[model samples]
Target: MDFMIAAAIAALLNIGLLGTIIVIYVQNTRLVQSYFTYGLITVASAFMVQNIVIVIFWFNLYTAGPAIKTIVDAAAPYLFVINLAQTVGLAVMVWINT
Candidate 1:
């Protein structure tokens, strides 16, 4: 599939996950009141932000000059790995706190 197509799909999935988490936060304030819950929210937000960045990167790659696209391409993988680590850390926080 094309990069833009893939990025659009990722953005939709990220939005879905963010929406679900927000709903969870709203529905179970008791469970979502803890520091771990905050951490989860933060991580999820960061993950969504990172995906947004990736989508921007794809947009730039398609529309921008080569230099800017190169920079975005170089940075996107690092952001993805950082987001992945944050996700794992959030999972650990949930496991430890529960």
Candidate 2:
């Protein structure tokens, strides 16, 4: 049951992240064109951070039981939000610079 729940949460988070990137990409087309290099750099950095987080979440699930897994799962959302902010901040800086 916990495994199923964790997998579902992971999938949903991935989907949400993808959706967010797409929306940002579309809305910030000007920045993407004028400052695409910087924008790409920011997106790549953000993605690496997010990937590390997802990997850590998986490790926690493997090393800890579902009880702890539950806590990690709860924390994942908050972590995502922080990373999202980081990503947006970078993009915004590039936007402003352009």
Candidate 3:
């Protein structure tokens, strides 16, 4: 029960983050013309896709038992790497742009 609640909360927060990024992207498509900004956009897009996958997995986890959690745990490493790459890319983009 606790795990399900936590996963639900995380999904909600990630959705909010993705929505914010989309808003920013829409407001300034011009930024993506630059190489660094383009990279950021690409990584962010990938992160969004990963987030969607995570949400699906999390939803499944919520309904399923402890065994399903192993799948989610297995994905953690991949998610961590992608998230790290995205974070670094975001920092670089900000540094380069500003």
Per-residue lDDT of model 2, residues 1-98, tens digit only: 34434543554455455445645665676555657755754774566466556656666675688668667667656655655555556455445544
Model 3 lDDT, full chain set? 0.60
Clashes of 2: 0
In model 1, the worst 10-residue window by lDDT is 1-10
lDDT of each: 0.59, 0.57, 0.60
The lowest-lDDT stretch of 10 consecutive residues in candidate 2 is 1-10
lDDT of 3 at 14: 59
Which model is ahead, 2 or 3, in terms of TM-score? Answer: 3
Q: Flag clash pairs in model 2.
A: none
